[model samples]
Target: MSDDLKVTAELRESFGKGAARKLRALGKIPAVLYGHGTEPVHVSLPGHQMLLILRKSNAVLELDIDGKGQLALVKDVQKDPVRQIIEHIDLIVVRKGEKVTIDVPIHLEGEAAPGTTVNQDSNTISLEALATAIPESVVVSIEGAEDGTQIFAKDLILPEGSSLITDEDTLIVAISIAQEQDLGEETDEAPAEEAAPAAE
Candidate 1:
């Protein structure tokens, strides 16, 4: 389940690349909050804390903005390609018990049968769960699975109060026998007579 962490945010008046750079220099991250039929609010959030909170998937936050508490869901995060530093974030407001559709990662546990390889076809599956109850990831066991075994989306056991939103026939994991290619045999060279004739 997603845990809501409290964070303090200050309203930001500056905009554009220059302003964002300044905020980053001061260890603040620029972000926008919008939802619940209200106008978008621009603010600056603490950089280190924001990065830590965002390490979890589908992070929820209880924002304290001037003594007014607001519930927000992590919607999007943009980052620098080389430095991998967070650039900006977009948060969507949500209420308790609100149902939201999100994609959760599939984690395969255990090993398949010997001489077989497990191939994952889908990395994520969509689910409809409560805003605060969204799972971090779904775990599927492949223990002792034999070759030609297939696990489909319809067969997934979802967490309580969650329902699958992805297609039922989606292929999640497939187990198959490992194929080995045989290298061609080396041929013997018909050798030295031609070199000796050329030398003569």
Candidate 2:
């Protein structure tokens, strides 16, 4: 794991909504770590630092729990609906080189052939990858793709250590001829109708 992914966490003994609110007031986030048949551990993490790290999807954190190191994969995040503030987080313990299944965002690159519009059917796909080696996202290039061209999940080129877990037949991107609107014809017809009403 990179040094930037490391965070020092404090074990928290408090519970309930009141306790969680207090932690957030102090710029801390409450999180639970559990997995591998171990009991769940509750801890508090720094708010600002976590927000920065979590901006990227499927973020894995190297947590320092009282000078002890542990690897955790971000499982879920709860946020305030209106404020969009991070409320709590769930982390799953993972071992080095362990394979974990997660969803990776899809990123499109390049433009399709001229006069063609590209449509993405799915925004993210599931993948199985090493806990620490998960790719941030998968890229699908539509460069020079002609109309009627389609790309499926099976056709995607994944990162070296990742394998696609999504259904093989899922459509990822489709390129088609752009539909043109006949605005000029509509305008001409509207003026004729108005002129008829005026003559009557």
lDDT winner: 2
TM-score of each: 0.88, 0.91
lDDT of 2 by residue, 1-200 (tens): 78879999999998999999999999999999999999999999999999999988988899999999999999999999999999999999999979999999999999999999899999999999999898999999999999999999999999999988999999999999876656667876998998997998
Q: How does candidate 2 score on lDDT?
A: 0.94
lDDT of 1 by residue, 115-172 (tens): 9989999999999999888898999999999999999999998989999999999999
Best by TM-score: 2
Model 2, position 102, has a per-residue lDDT of: 97
TM-score of 1: 0.88
